[model samples]
Target: MATLSYNPSKLRNHKPQSHKPISSLSKPIKIPFSSSQFSTLYPSKFSKLRLNSVSESSVSLPTNQPPLTSASENNFNEDEEVDDDPTSEVSYLDSETDPENIIEWELDFCSRPILDIRGKKVWELVVCDGTLSLQFTKKDSIFQVANADNYNKGLQELGIKPVPSKRCLSLLLWLEERYETVYMRHPGFQVGAKPLLALDNPFPMDLPENLIGEKWAFVQLPFSAVQEEVSSLEERFAFGASLDLDLLGIEIDDKTLIPGIAVASSRAKPLAAWMNGLEVCSLEADLAKASLVLSVGISTRYVYATYKKSVATTQEAEAWEEAKKTCGGLHFLAIQENLDSDDCVGFWLLLDLPPPPV
Candidate 1:
């Protein structure tokens, strides 16, 4: 038999076979690897590995395979998971139960109209807001008084009938009695042409039974008495308070009954402007004669005055000094006459009564 000799150059010159397109493949190709080899290579356990053909965009994951999570993520606490959830409802019971969250309601006063039984004009009193609406009759009183003709004329312009002077007087008396109940416990009254009214009740409807019975009273004073008695009382008393009475336009001879609200001295102004027609020199002279030592208290609504009573005791003097330190001291000092006396007069002289002991 004759053996055919093949040259290496002939094989090199031969054309190679063409490959088929991957899109023509019927199924995904398998990646051949042993379990031990995979463990050694990747340090992870995976079964039945598959690879997509070149024509496919992505590989299909096995349904039985667990998602790959990092060690840090796997170790996360359960609380953190709950916090991460946006829909989680947080409890605020701790904050709600805190004592700091509790707030005391404060009383605020305003002015309102007083209508008679016939819904006509009754002389308007500077009363608390809710009080008039609650206490006054809705109907207008038939009795008309001639004394308030000017007032009645003004009311007639507004289409309101005038209330009789007799009826008006009766209503005033009744209102005073009613207000006494409301203000008896309170320290003083705030009096002015336009005073604040109580639009809403300061106390909650569900307040404790004991608190419901608590009452406040108004300290009614005449403008003249305030002017005369205030200086004398300050001279005699160790304690005094400041108030803002500039809006009142109180004249020396005017018989305006100014109501003062009871408030802590701290709330009072350090100095106030003197009401219209008040003589500064006379007031200063009065204050100087008494050698008055003034100390402001908690509220500015009323000033407390008491006679010095044979010189202040050592303890009382010390206490007055301390109060002066705490409450910004008296508006006027006997030695400090050249200072702003008008400001001192306006702010410090609310009333001429001695304050109750702290």
Candidate 2:
């Protein structure tokens, strides 16, 4: 969006927005989400809106947390803090008693813009727990999900805090079903549907020789800038592809600088265009192999950069470590003509979400 230009100099004087710190949270690990969730994960028309507007809003962990109604929710006391630690050991002996035995549920809050009965636009929140239970049944006047206060207050009334992130899986499925079984049958609703890219194998393919960049460097950018820049990206961009950074169990503010890698090349545009075709995932380091890897199309992997493991490459390893600790393994790959140029040819936000639990 906006002709892919990044001014590195701006970061020097950049003052990040004020928000809750990641360390302030009671727990630091996200509840483990299921790999099966990927099958239903698709970007709807509301994706870009959510990503641009409330991407930084407080979110609940998706994994190992149960959705509680007024009656069953009594298990969690008001004084006892609910810990949705993703690293906890799970025993399958009792699903009801074992926190780890519970599967992660997807939630979507107010991200979908829909028309109400009076033709007024409204945002709705859909919360589904591990058992596929719905918390708030009244869809007539659901609270606006963007305001974090409204979200938490509604949950607090029901004895829940930091409600789960509404990733909008249920809404996506309903829309898809409606389009196929209902809408397609009608002439007026026969318009093109939103493009969907399902997660493939996590492995990434090596870039074609011609698509390789002339130079690359590890760099950082403000989360707000990334969110702001993507809004203007044309139809050729992958705006909806993202992993729950909340999965990192850390809340990042708009001003938080996101660490990533930048590539400068004469063929930047084409390189970016090619990536648009694949489901680009995350950038990671293979310390044992002394190589930088890019994960795309689900399980597919690619060798982005390789170096000898020695004192010379020590900084490379350190960058990877710091990024993992700071951003929940989230990173980026930006293709540009040169390091100094403000205009970027392509930018891809990469996330290193944890693998599914066994």
lDDT tens per residue, model 2, 45-157: 11211110111111222344443333233443424433322111111121234444435444444322223334433334444333332222112234454454665777679
Using TM-score as the measure, the top candidate is: 2
For candidate 1, give the lDDT of residue 257: 31
lDDT of each residue in 186-295, candidate 1, tens digit only: 22222232312222112212322221111111122334444443444456442343232332112232233332212112112322211111211111111222222221
TM-score of each: 0.17, 0.43
Model 2 residue 86 lDDT score: 17
Worst 10 residues of 2 by lDDT: 48-57
lDDT of 1 at 175: 39
- Candidate 2 TM-score over all chains jointly: 0.43
